[model samples]
Target chain A: MAVQTIGHAPASSSHKGMSPLRRREAINGYVAILPWFLGFLIFTAGPMVYSAWLTFNSWELITPPRWVGLANFRFLLEDQLFRTALWNTFIYTVVSVPLQLLIALGVALLLNLNIRGTNLYRSLIFLPSQTPVVASAMLWFFIFSPTQGLANAGIGLFGIPPQRWLWDVNLVKPALIAIAVWAFGGAMIIFLAGLQDIPQSLYEAADLDGATPFSKLLNITVPLLTPTIFFNLVIGLIGAFQVFTPVYLMTGGGPGTSSMMMGLLIYRHGFEEFNMGYASLLAWVLFLIVITLTIIQFSLARRWVYYEGDRD
Target chain B: MDTHVSPEVKNLQGQRPLMQDHAADDTTARSRSLVVPRKRRAVVVHLILFAVAAVSLLPLLYMVSTSLKARGREFAYPIEWIPNPAVWRNYLTAVETVEAMTFFANTMIVTTLTLVGGILTASLAAYGFARTRFPGRDFLFMLMLSSLMLPYMVTLIPQFVLFRELGWINTLYPLIVPAFFGGAPFYIFLLRQFFRGLPTDLEDAAKLDGAGFFRIWWTVAMPLAGPALATVAILSILHHWNDFIAPLVYLHTRDNWTLALGIRLFRDQYQVLFNLTMAYAVMMTVPVFTVFFAFQKYFVRGITISGMGGR
Candidate 1:
């Protein structure tokens, strides 16, 4: 309906003394964007609305759907697994996002020095991030293997005792966090681009002021880099919240549901158990949380994020 | 100004920067003391970078090493950094156990079709948004962008049901069809920025030659967008090659599974045989690594352009 309205409104408005060239352009514009518009309606907006409706009903993919008002949402509130998934996802997001950003920033700073073999170093660092998630998870699984794992062997050199990683309930989330952090190369590359964008004159001006490297980093680099930081932060938060693959493959929210994540929970319910209604409800809850947090971040961003050319 | 200059003068002018660099080098040699600390710092920087790079690559290196190790020795205590007797058989076993050739074929088919569809559709939509104007254009673009924030999980179930109704389940259509429509919103945004940055003078000249909008776009705009198109192609290849969830949700039967799904299945079936699993992982990862290395410049440029959009 919205698509039809927008499509017709443009053509109708063209009749109000609009020139022929402008009318042609308007029509061409609609035609060009038609594919994406159709996709939005079918894959995105339509499914979203259908998902909301399914949340209010019970459908097991066999029988006809039955309306059960507010039942899914009510059960979602009290579901212990849902709460565990939420808390686990929240903790993962809170810890991993900032930690990954910080690591990326540090590596980016080092690479920005333009040292010899900078390209080689950058390529090596970023290669892991390109490793398929399933492969990366398997790699880390071997790395954290308790008996013959490289992790224990490396710790053994330091005289530290062996620890079960993905198997131990207490250690599973932290292990997952470490695996997530290992893929910070993507963020690192973005930060490297951001670092390169800072005008050399700013650093030169700081040099003229006899600024120490630390102070220069504090005043010039960090302030100028805030926008990039904000971008990475938002992207990182959104990604970290929806972390599914590694957890699904490595731990499967195992060792007593210690590592259950929201994405995995949705998958379990919808696909595994054929409980689409409850899965939709859980997904909606996750969506609301992400949206609320994103909004909060944006509001808070005004206080700290620096845009170079902004007047206000 | 150039016309007044003789050939000799022009040659001298060309050499001026080289002469200046020599003079600067002489001064820097004289101030060798000043350069020493800087050189030392450069060494320290190199050392730090090397250490970090090595650590960053350690996991992948370990993966390669384990993949080559004898099966039972994969978890040996004193981890073998280099397997003395390399187990090339593990790769064969991994491939055979999972019927990986079939999966690889499926993956190639999905990836190639998705790449073709994604690039053509996303670039078309991007050209429309960037080069054309219509009522509510900005509103429509913003609406598209805002949809990026919607979690994929919210749409997963409904889409599954929709495709199931269409009898597209256990087929590659669910994974490939949407790509034909619009690909991903992010790709469109990236291409839109690129298309906007291109000059319009050529298009204007084409228009004067009686070229239509579609002709100008195909001959003028798309040709000039080589770097951006390459970027989109590389990203699409990597995405479809690595995508797991979509294929997992849609392709139920083993006959239709992609390489990603097959790798997971390999891991599940051969969980204890870390060597075989590592081999499977390595096999699946090589193509992506090759693509990234070959198009390293475009990949970095694409990311830089995306970051620039935030500004």
Candidate 2:
């Protein structure tokens, strides 16, 4: 039957020629995807090339862009604010992403105990994530207000005096990190799904072997959930690096640039300062850092991430 | 007889009898020997979950509490969990203070159009990538997928320039037009995964009946894609509803402000009025929470599918 089917294919169509149906399908496929293709070129691909070109110039949005090769790049190397923004974003991503994932995974495991009220617990935990970042930023702003804020009141109960939260350079990043952690519910739900995908039999087998819960988690659950962990890690890292709205709204990258992030810095240069060229350069730098990190993560994933159906 | 094994687990058990036997034995033995410890564990788990849930909800609760507080009482030490007499009028004041009604109208217009256009364009492109076979299809799809890693910041300045050149600055066009052109790669990828999972027999039958690809996509495939479409719609609504950066950049006049921009402006202008600002924030959040609760299942399914690499 296989040999007959193979023989029929060449008999019906000349070599290196598509049959009529194949050609029609190809046409339909192109027509179907045309909007996305146009969008790619006009919005994504074209703008990317334009931005790269812009990085070489020093246009101020009004005057025609004049090419100045690598001047923006040279200035970028020496710009104190640029370095501060990059370092702040790096610190935020390095600290927050892992912490959020750990908390998310922990909550997901707790929710997966098959206890009653699971749905309610899940909704309650996930509610904060649904709140708009703008609104949440404002809410946190009030909560962190130095004298009248809930942060101080809550800590005062613990006998620790209220320190300046967003105003204090030492505390600003941690305050922002706390806000990011509050919305880990998105990752939590993903982790819950991953937990559910793990076959119960593995857990039952471990139980039958008298494995402790921690042992079962380390040996069975952790291995099975590695793919999910990797997914959250990559996503969280990218998101944390682009931290903007909170900083833009709450601190405006201040208390002396302590919370300055790449996203806000780009916004300031491009929109506020009208320095489109430098802003484009900063954005490209951000793009390169994110791409490099994602590549590294993917390469490292091979050693750790376990896909269930891998032949190896 | 263990109640904890979900139906999905039971389905897995039906496929493997050996594991099923072990599960059975393990459950019986564990239930007999560990009833007391299991009950204690349940209590402990519930306590932990309750604590976490409180932490999650506290800030929101505080927002509500502050929004209703009598004006000066916002900074009252030993934080008031509830207002003495709820300042329900604060909602009215929030609205009156900043053309809140106009902002609502603007936000609704932008969100609705973007939601409809995003779903339409994204689903069409998803159908092409998912259901059709063509040369360079995989290559194009991967190319599109790689764009997901390209930060929006990279495109922000140029797109701003492009829109400025088109004379679209200060208009809603900048925000609304992109959605009609598959602006969201993630949505297309998501809908593609959904389309791929759908059974193809119906599509094949439609083809045999002389229906064209578009007809099949609309009648056969789209009808079956209600869940995914709903997921995309909900996500799109939430995104455009909460979008700050676009409106902040594009809409210069207060007359054209969306709720996000309006609320931010309110915060800036009324820096001392925490109550009114909280009131405005609550108003902006209500719609999102309503949509979320109404379609909670789709949110879970969407996130789950995303985590699985759109399997």
Candidate 3:
């Protein structure tokens, strides 16, 4: 009755016509979101469905897509280079994600200190993270060159011998991990924000009871910080799994596929090799691995992640 | 955009005054007795931070120094840490040999369009999801968010085909057009969260004044969403400017390349020329620092507001 009374006229000028208020709102909503809806349909949803089909069909750009069910998947299982790429990428992600998180959290804790010039430190630390990935990848190339690199030059300052970096097969992924860890500023800022969100009263109460700083951190700070830690862990995993540009630009998956990630292999198959079916299959496999990892993380998250009001 | 001071930010606010009080207490305590320990600790903290800053910024310094060093000295043994004769012509030469100006202009066109178009489309969609009352709104929004979980690799192949069929291949159109439609799921979600945080009173007043939906959106919400819009704009610019894969896939012509693509091509063309490639790296890297420094506050605020996994 109130809704009917709120409007001046019926939307369609008939007794059974919808209320002008409801009709107008529905129209406005459709009009407002239509651009993205059409986009979501064409660009995202439509292509996703099509890419699935491409996975089962062998198609180069010029040729008609030929059906070859299961063959693409079979190829992936047997491809030696595919296995190498998977191994290399896993090593990179497993080694780097935890290391990155620890450093970022430590930096965040430092920045959270009630001290002057924290903002300057935050900006300085985060500055490297803002460098375009392509540029950073190129910068690392110079840093990794055995004879003439900054890595060697810096070690020389400490009276240590020069070392071959990414050029050496054994050291390539480690060098990439080291480079990856340097860009932890993004995660650090998130941790800083998370630290700010922890209630100060908890700390003050702990202080009143004469709690040691380290004990307070372990008991209060770490427990309260599980959600942010989980957030970084998930994001870092997704990002690390898709390591591409640096591998492609710096090494070309080289020194015998020592640094090839699944993404670079997929790129090589689809674009460089012109085998779209195999590439799409590889991509789908990558997608599934990421999805499974995410699902596992979420199920695990239930054990540790605490919402502020969850207890309440 | 930080419309709600969550318990954590509130805690931070409370803690600052407490710290200041501690500092005051320290001063009084020093007058009464010993303050040397706390002073020494603060000095140690500063020294540690100084070391980190040097390590963090060294690669950047190397890039710049290499770009400026006299031509052959870039790879000199016992390296020229501070280029002896900081020759600036590498910049001029890198640009000339690579047609980098063309790449820059092309990148600007694509990035600016993406920024303007993305904000408009995403903001409109966000308003629909956040402010308007409609049937199936929650369902539709969930569907939209689900796309965030769908890896771009899954969609990359057919999207390339879509553009190829549209004859947008080897041009900036492939890069620019999708943004005009919806931009990205992340940006749409960010803007939606921003819109949801606005007070209901503004829209209620607009309705009382008989302002229609579009008018209310323009006058009431848009006016108050400057910070959110700016954050989206800056993020979009950064993403588009730094995009490598899209340009690498779509753009085959040197003239159509963006700065990222230009650098990759320049690297291949001068693979062993450390100075030239580093010069290109410097050119690509400098703008990111500029934008980040200028808008660091807005960037931080936006992240805190939306950073809980952007869900």
Candidate 4:
């Protein structure tokens, strides 16, 4: 693609195959996209290579990187905070992703019902998803305020006493998870779109076979919706792992590192502490985990993520 | 700013025809029998949906009530669902405290610039992928898609370093400049899908009219891509407006903070002023909501249409 565009610039420009206008068009299109290409090379691709290079060193941003092959890796192996962050990220991802997908599927299924003003229900459910996370986090900060928050007030109705949401280290991740679940509208919207695309013929066929709703869901809908479900799940997992804003806003990664997400930790190192090299190492670790998990997902997806239209 | 009209769609006229046609066919075809049963069931189902809708609106309702309540009444025991002495100063105080106008100005600048840069970059790459038929185009596109799986956490540090090198660390440049370069691959892919779906005839006609690629894209393709472009614009604005981490990383001075960052400061600095905080929260949401409701039809239409094509 690069060659063809480059070739079209000079080689094909001389072929009389096109006018100056065509050549100009080719140049302009490439020019318009050049910023991103340059950015990818300088910012994205460059950092990726530098990150790998930094992974093997103990260099700070000020000093030249000292090649201490495998030392940073070994240091990370023994780093307790890295271990905690990794475990927290895993626990957060595993707990949140499936729960989110389940809730999203449930909401989408409910919205799928033929009903009056279903659009209103969709809009309402989708409202939280669109609300800026910073705003939502602020709202939740008050809502979960240990003393006089609404959540505790509401839960008191069910007789559960007040809990320190962001204050308690153990409850912090769960609190974040509960807050994260509120934004299931993204997954729900995707699932709703997916649900709409399911051919009615399948349901009719299942109904003719005397399949109950549960049976039909199990035999048809679940299997057919797997592709979308998989997509939402994978994306949700990646997003959940990198979740920083809410943690940053609601907890400041505190009451002491409880909400210190990988993203936050990296931010602290690279930006706050100016330890770009070490932060790059942490970033690389995060990249490896995401890639590995995503690969595993795609591999397992073949077994479960059914594309009903693709009848081989 | 109009609350009734959706931002992207001016008239329901576009979708109304199809819905009416479907409804008509549905009634006529099913009128022979079982229509009454289905309609009865659908009515019952709708009531249930209405209850769900009410449940969903509860939080917003709570926020409004809290915003109205006087300072002490906000946290009063046996919590008041309605404000006793409705305090209008909540809005005034919240707006006054955080330099809300400055924050809004900053937000608008960031959003507008990001939107412009994002659209230019995304559309350019999309056009390349859609029309060029170049070698490794598919491969490069796939590479972009793979990058989507690489969490933002990965490239963040490197990006910070690159920005620091360019002396963009404390400016809006880091946030705005990268946007001009296919920063978000998802949107680029979306634009690519939309571009591919558009018929080639228009561009060809433009070509025969002695127009170049840029001219064809701008005059021919863009005019026909109102809904898609609106979709891209709305998504870009929302992303830029709501972004927190990038600004938090790149911005050092308090004056440069975006609304999202400003809101966080409000919550932290005024921990006891629950009513004012809620007011701030509401103010932040109102504009986005207004934009949302204004272009709701187009917003939903764009989503459904974009999804159908993109995936």
Identify the leading candidate in terms of DockQ.
Answer: 2
* Worst 10 contiguous positions by lDDT, candidate 3 chain A: A1-10
| Tens-digit lDDT string for candidate 1 (A72-160) | 98898789999999999999999988988898899899899888889999989888777888899888988998776988887899998
Model 2 agreement with the true structure over B1-311: per-residue lDDT tens digits: 34244443333233332354566567667768788998899999999999999999999999999999888899998788978889999999999988989889999899989987898889999999887766667778888888887777889899999999999998899999999998488899888888988989999999999999999999999999999998888777777888888899999998888999876655444366889989999998888788778888886776665541111
The TM-score each candidate achieves on chain A is 0.94, 0.94, 0.92, 0.86
Q: Would you estimate the TM-scores of all the predictions?
A: 0.91, 0.92, 0.90, 0.86
Cα lDDT listed for each candidate: 0.83, 0.85, 0.80, 0.73
Return the DockQ of model 4: 0.26
What fraction of the true Cα-Cα contacts (under 8 Å, chains A to B) does candidate 1 also have? 0.62
lDDT (tens digit, per residue) of candidate 3 on A152-183: 88888999888888888888888999888988
For candidate 4, write residues A24-48 as lDDT tens digits. 5545656655665676787677889
User: How large is the i-RMS for each model, in angstroms?
Assistant: 8.6, 6.4, 7.5, 9.9
- RMSD for all candidates, in order, please: 7.4, 5.2, 6.2, 8.6
Clashes of each: 0, 0, 1, 7
- Please give the range of 10 consecutive residues that has the lowest summed lDDT in model 2 chain B: B9-18
Q: Which stretches of candidate 1 lie over 4 Å from their true place?
A: A1-14, B1-34, B267-271, B304-311
lDDT of 4: 0.73
For model 3, which pairs clash?
A197-B8
Q: Over 4 Å off in model 3, which ranges?
A: A1-18, B1-34, B267-271, B302-311
Per residue, candidate 2 scores C-alpha lDDT tens digits across A155-201 of: 98889998899999999999999999898888898999889889888
Report how far residue B292 has shifted in candidate 3, in Å: 1.4
